[model samples]
Target: MKLKTPLLLLLVALTSCGNKPDLVQDNFSFASTQLKQAFVEMDAVRSAEPREKQALRDKQNLGPLASPRNVEADGTLHMVISRDWTSGFFPGELWYMYEYTKDDFWKQKAREQTALIEREKMNGGTHDMGFKVYCSFGNGYRLTGDAAYKDVLLQAAYTLTTRYKENVGAIRSWDHSRDKWDCPVIIDNMMNLELLFWAFKTSGDSLFYNVAVNHARTTMKNHYRKDYSSYHVVDYDTITGAVLHKHTHQGYAHESAWSRGQAWGLYGYTLCYRETGLPEFLEQAKQIENFIFSHPNLPKDLIPYWDFNAPGIPAEPRDASAATVTASALYELSMYDPANGKDYVMKANTILENLSKGYRTAPGKDRGFLLLHSTGSKMHNVEVDVPIVYADYYYLEALLRKQKLEKEGTAIL
Candidate 1:
């Protein structure tokens, strides 16, 4: 699952080729073109389904398969149902498109896709309400001020709180794999706290705020090592509130730094600082930034391998998803840390440029996924090197943030 050596060399060359004045704008234009074609192809697949199947889906109240998760082994579109954690990302991408282009077409498409995930507002089986709902409906609400979207977000926030265990001081991450973990809380759960924060601000509920802060504080204490590299999963004794195990579930080993987990910690703590103005959260984010950018294993292009400690070095698969997340977090972190702001922006820009130049799917290829070579879970041998939905979501997000920073000197949007 390693990237071809020739492609890796080309990526390095492209990263060193220097930046262009219109890189963000040009990439946005390219993304819009590619996504339009993707939408058409996706819709065709939905339309080609048998009438009986469609009727049964309607009767069962199953929403249309509106989100593109990834491409299957045969290169067919792998669209997912509403409950999938990634279901919100495609709609979020459409929202970013609308935000960038201000086109009614993208806005209408965003609305349609966002609406499909509304049923997940009550899905508390997993600790990914933010990924499954907020990225879709939350963005929709942010853009349109839609009252219904607001209601759904608040309800989703309440449902997410159901997973919170006061004893563990964290939201339970998984209900399955009971054999492996008592109360597993993964680093990825940090990303879901955004929904709770937003709900607190919107609904004036201290419960939402407290749960988010507790989770952040608890995770800050338990999930990270002295070097600020994070474990992928931290199992806890649910009743005793004591740490039971620290597992690198998706990484190279029990103690290796999972690339995406590091990105999540960096982004999550940065966001926590934004929401709560806590110096500790800011410092944690900075430590993670240093760890990622200073790591010798990080590629010259700023795209990290699937695991920072993966044994294969140059031959390991790159995770474009991690780069996208890191780039997006850096744009926000730059706004907060002024002394290093320029450097963070420069690194983020390099990542975006390298991704655009080297990792992007060829025009009209891979069913129009924006980028390639993301590893979802290398340990499980899943999605080792492929185009993932969240990579495209965060790529669009980073592009939008870059544009905002350029125009307004702020990356808030």
Candidate 2:
């Protein structure tokens, strides 16, 4: 029943995902009036775009499902359609839009965009199956309970598990060997565990669940530093399972924390706790939160410099993507911890507010990207200070989470 899949390597390394079902009671109270303007404005912006037609401009990025990348040399916004991790995010965006508005236009667009990336379910070479498939199809299944989406998701999990090594007790993150990296695992890989965990729950398959658990445990053991800040990449010896090297592929230095990488770790482990109810995962999430929020470099607006330790400090470009992810993770984190949840809820609200004003794009502008100022790989000198699809995806996701928490007293992770 499991069909075999893959992540971004050149553009990103092990791009992004989660865990068990938790019985959560939402007790927090908040007024949801402010976000509706952003929601309505963004919806109108998205509705105005001919996304399906524009996506056809770049088959290299995957085709009609391509999301906006950045401005090309011609001063027009460029879109990319790759088997890259971010490909599925566009569809996920539409899914969220549908969820938020209950409009048939978003629903139809979601289906069309989702259909373009179905081939990725069989792409087993990359480790980003969760970002590629689950973000799109997983949402589809969650919303519609379509059996076809379920099949795609199950096959995607099977493909993802192929990358797991019993010796390493982790799924290999990158296939390429750079320097002495024989088997490289990036922190971003932590985000891919959601698909496997979801598969186990839906199919009653232990292989998927066990692999997800082991990978989370392994990453938890090795990825974190003393302050709970994380290394972006950890290479391992295939046979001995020893760490070969630790470096930041996208951060300022090998020792610096990449903001989005930190976001990935926070979101990933928090999700693992949601699925497994493991206290360790929750504690890890807290430690990560402490490291990020307590860090002196964090802007008062909650958006972070591309790397917390980037040399430029305040001069560095802020990564709205990291802020969006952190806010989204914090909203989910608020569900389980009574002592910290209130603070997290406040933090999440502040982030949403800052992003809506400082980072939001006007209607019919910036290629209809929801949030701006996301940095992709500052090291590669690409996608810097640009609108990124994942930033928007998580931004909308955080907004939806806030809306749900306010209205139903429940956060849907």
Candidate 3:
């Protein structure tokens, strides 16, 4: 069958991914080239689009799919701003630029973004603040030793800890509506648990770590489907503590896998394994990875359709954003499984190469946003096939991971 070629190619690709020092050296050269290119792009973006004028909060007012291209739809370049759920991701993007190039321009943007976020703060009662803020700020403080970043991150962590409901033994999420849903949990929230776990170590607050672990356990028990693909949303009864319903808000149906959400589960559980060393978490991550990689319908690039099972192929389109997230997750997972790490590394490499080569704009259409063809909340029918800020963030993160692995003389595919 024609489809068999990619499967056969996957096996063949795995062979070259062995523990060859030359592979590491080759990867290092490639990564260095890309990093240098990223620096060039970041500097160009910074010079062209100054941070103060286009502050972080500008993202709030913009409509969906409202990228820098949104300027075209409207007369003024009304940049969206505000500390929303997607708030933490922008800083992560800037931090990646700073980390790779040591560019003071990126650092200044990151600092300004952090200050703006802390000053207003988002609807902090939800669990996502950890990912949207702490992952950016926590990682930022760890890298720079900047006390201001530390202060803002600590405040955000404290806000998250305060929301930990002892009754449900988990953190609550999204309180704008749906009042009856007391102990609401999302698989996406699992990635945010690392922020709390890190907060515990940074601040010596065991409660934060304990809370994160409990929340993770609760999610593992409730969210995973029979096939190991996770649900987008799980409603837990605040009183009886039973799972009320497992649904998929972002997917086509309650059972369909939202590609990015699945990536979050794969990435989050791997993170849980790293933090707790629990075999179950790693086991789940591996199972999810198998489901993700083994999907026959995935494009040659390995980036998944927005909903893998969504009817219609080229007409419906795949979410390059999901592929980017999974690429970074697979790269992180590769570190733990040396024997099979190459398969993941190869998959990650496939995704990144395709993204950089296929999904990236021609460097002329969009000067500000880096990667292209990212889907943001396709269920709500918004931001289809445009640059998502977080997609650029994860794409850069994957690159940094490759850079780190190559520098450490590790195998890279």
- Scored by lDDT, the top model is 1
- What value of lDDT does candidate 3 attain over all alpha carbons? 0.70
N/CA/C clash count, model 2 = 13
Tell me the tens digit of each residue's lDDT in model 2 across 146-255: 99999999998999999998899999988776556888888999889999989889889899989998999888888888989999988888899998788899999998
Estimated TM-score per prediction? Answer: 0.93, 0.84, 0.80
Q: Which order, best to worst by lDDT? A: 1, 2, 3
| Residue 171, candidate 2: alpha-carbon lDDT | 96
- Backbone clash count, each prediction separately: 0, 13, 11
TM-score winner: 1
TM-score (C-alpha) between model 1 and the true structure: 0.93
lDDT of 1 at 45: 79
Worst 10 residues of 1 by lDDT: 16-25
Q: How are the candidates ranked when ordered by TM-score, highest leading? A: 1, 2, 3
Q: Write the per-residue lDDT of candidate 1 for residues 1-413, one digit (tens) a residue.
A: 89999999999878876554477777888888789878887987788878897788789877678688987667778887897789999999999999888899999999988888999998879799999898999899999999999999999999999999999999999999999899999999999999999999989999999999999999999999998899989999999999999999999998999999999999999999999998999999999999999999998999999999999899999999999999999999999999999999999999999998899997777887899999999888888799999999999999989989998998888
**Clash pairs detected, candidate 1:** none
Instruction: Give the per-residue lDDT digits (tens) of candidate 3, residues 1-413.
Output: 35588888987778766644342234333434443444444445446765654554356442221112221222222233344566666667667667766769768867766554564233555667776677577668867998887777777777887767776777877675586455667778877787777778788988888888888888778888788888888887777777787888778788888888899888888888887788888888899999888887677778788887777765776787788788888887888778888898888878877776677654434435566677766777766666666776677778777767656844221
RMSDs, each prediction?
7.9, 13.1, 8.3
**2 against 3, candidate with superior lDDT:** 2
